[model samples]
Target chain A: MSKKKITIAITGLNNTDNPGPGVPFIRAIRESDRFDATVIGLAYENLEPGIYMNGITDKTYLIPYPSSGSEQLLARIEQIHRKNPIDVLIPNFDAELFTFIKNESWLRERGIKTFLPEMESFMERSKDNLSSFGKKYDFKVPKSLPLTGAHQVDQLFEELDFPVFVKGKFYDAYKAWDKHEVNTLFHKISAKWGLPVMVQEFVEGTEVNVIALGDGKGNTIGAVPMRKTYITDKGKAWGGITIDDEKMLSLTYDIIRKTKWRGGMELEMIRTRDNEYYIIEINPRLPAWLYLAVAAGQNLPEAMVRLALDEKLEPFHAFKSGKMFIRYSYDLIGDISLFESITVKGEL
Target chain B: MRIKRSVAVSENGFVFDSSTGDSFNLNGIGREIVELMKNGLEQSDITQKIIERYEVEPAIFEQNLMDFQSMLRQFNLLEE
Candidate 1:
């Protein structure tokens, strides 16, 4: 039987030193034999490598940044939809997701479907709100203080210990061992990402990441836990290996069940030396290393696409253990004219 | 200024220094300047070429180019 053709638009195409999940998500979709997809790459920057990647995206269009407001973003999507109607739009950036979630009904009116968590779920899972989320769910989460100003950094030591993690609201984390370092990072992060910086307790242990899909009905569609073997200076996983940890898997299922989460999510957890699991952060979308889940036979992106299309699927019960992924950089040679085209026309 | 003899650059703006075993990615303008440097072009000549083709001003491009040169040097991709 011939596969049905579908047009799916995805954002967060910035695959750089600090990578985005778009390319990996595209790879998973391409690997699936279930659908013949027209993958549309939505980029905010012209230099995003995925935009220029040959044969990965059928077409590429530049989208307005999230800070430009949802109205502008909706207009851009509508423009793209007029030319090529999109069936599903998977926003892969955490920063842009709030806009997408807020405009879900508007997007649905235009026939653009999305699989995302409810607004409350998305808000509760934020780094600043994780402490309350953990308390409500009866799970272990690091102690975190949300700071709206630089002056709050001075008071952090009173409640939190030294060597706490100073994190931006959307991205970036720096370990501060002293007041000076905390002050510097507080200002630095606040300057770039805006107010409400998070000061999280430093949990020392092995960092384990889990990629999971929820069915929006307290069911975990799939889950894969991985251990970062080598991390870049930017705190990105350079090399990682999947581990067989039932506790980690159970914790993932528990979170999904409790939240009744929908769509793709990545839970960053640390397994302490005392054998306790502390969920550090919850990424609302598929992570940059999502292809690793596909490699491990979970194929979460494919499952997510199926769910988005309203196709019923049984929960994924098994995945291969001991799988590994080592990310490497590749130069995709292109013409100077291509760069000029994307820079000038905002599409390629 | 010159790109180190051991550095390999690809058209896609990927730079690798075999001696240091370090790999780096360059933006489009960075790649253009590096290629021009490889051809033994002076900083002013490369800056002139960039300003002619791109929509950037000479002063801004020169300042950015100097910063980029500093980055190149820090990464050991450049030599005096």
Candidate 2:
């Protein structure tokens, strides 16, 4: 007997210097023997390497940017569904997750299933609300102040020290060492991503990350913690090693239990010299480095697919510790005609 | 402009600079331009080749080629 073939639509396929998680997500699915799948790559740019990479996607389609609003995105998804019904959609970008989560019901009505965090869960865990989240969840987060204007930058110095982190709501973080740098970044970030730029205290510690899945019922499906051994200038993990840290695992379980989170999440933290874990960010989707978790034995992406299909699954018991992952760049060879086809026709 | 003699470029667009111990991936156009540079092709020759092969305007191809050359310089792949 053969396993059923599942059609999964995925986004964030930009496998560049700063990669998206789509390629790794598809890799996990391909490695799984439980279910065969036809991977549909939803890309934003014509140059996304995943679209051209062989054995990664069966079909690729261009989608509107999230800035184009949820209505346009839904329309594009609907068009794709008309051609091939999407069994499940696993959106991997932080900026786009809100749009997908907002239209979750509409997608389900169209027979496109998605397992995502509840709206409230997604909202409260954002970087803007991290301080309050830490307060409510009884965890230590770095002191952060949300600045909506230039005037707020002046007051930031009184409350926080120099060398604070200036962060955009969706992306970009720069360490500003003086008031001039703070105000400069404030305007830069505001110009790009709009107001309410975050000012966070620079916590001195080693950075660590955990990728985990929750069952939406306060039960953790699986969790794997890793420490970056080498990071690129863009702050992306180029090499990392999985470690067996009881405290980090416990903290992951506690957060999931508190939020009753559904689907995949990545927790970025900083462990101080004293061994205190200060969670810096909570990404509601799988990280680009999530293949490390699958390689270590969790296979969370496969579990997520099953969970989205409403299949009952037992929590992952154990994963191999001390596993290391070194990311390498692979040049996907293709002709200029393929690029022109996608650029002109919007699909390949 | 000349490509550094120590820069190892594979047919698959994997560029490894032994002097700096850095590796990079290039798109098809980028690889073609770099290969042309290695072969000591003039700027006009490279521009002509790209315009004939790609479905892009000659002016746009020139602008893109300049940008790609700037990136190569930024990555220190060009000889001083």
lDDT of candidate 1 over A191-210, digit per residue (tens): 99997899999999878889
For every candidate, how close is chain A to the native chain A in TM-score? Answer: 0.98, 0.98
lDDT measured at residue A56 in model 2 versus the true structure, 0 to 100: 95
What are the clashing pairs of model 2?
Answer: none
Model 1, TM vs. native: 0.81
Error of 1 at A112 (Å): 0.9
lDDT of 2 by residue, A266-323 (tens): 9999988666899999989889999999998999999999999999999997886667
Give the docking tier of candidate 1: incorrect
Instruction: Quote model 2's TM-score.
Output: 0.80
Per-residue error at A179 for model 1, in Å?
0.7
In terms of docking quality, model 2 is incorrect
As for candidate 1, its clashing pairs are none
Q: Model 1 chain A, poorest ten-residue lDDT window?
A: A148-157
Chain B vs. true chain B: TM-score for each candidate? 0.94, 0.94
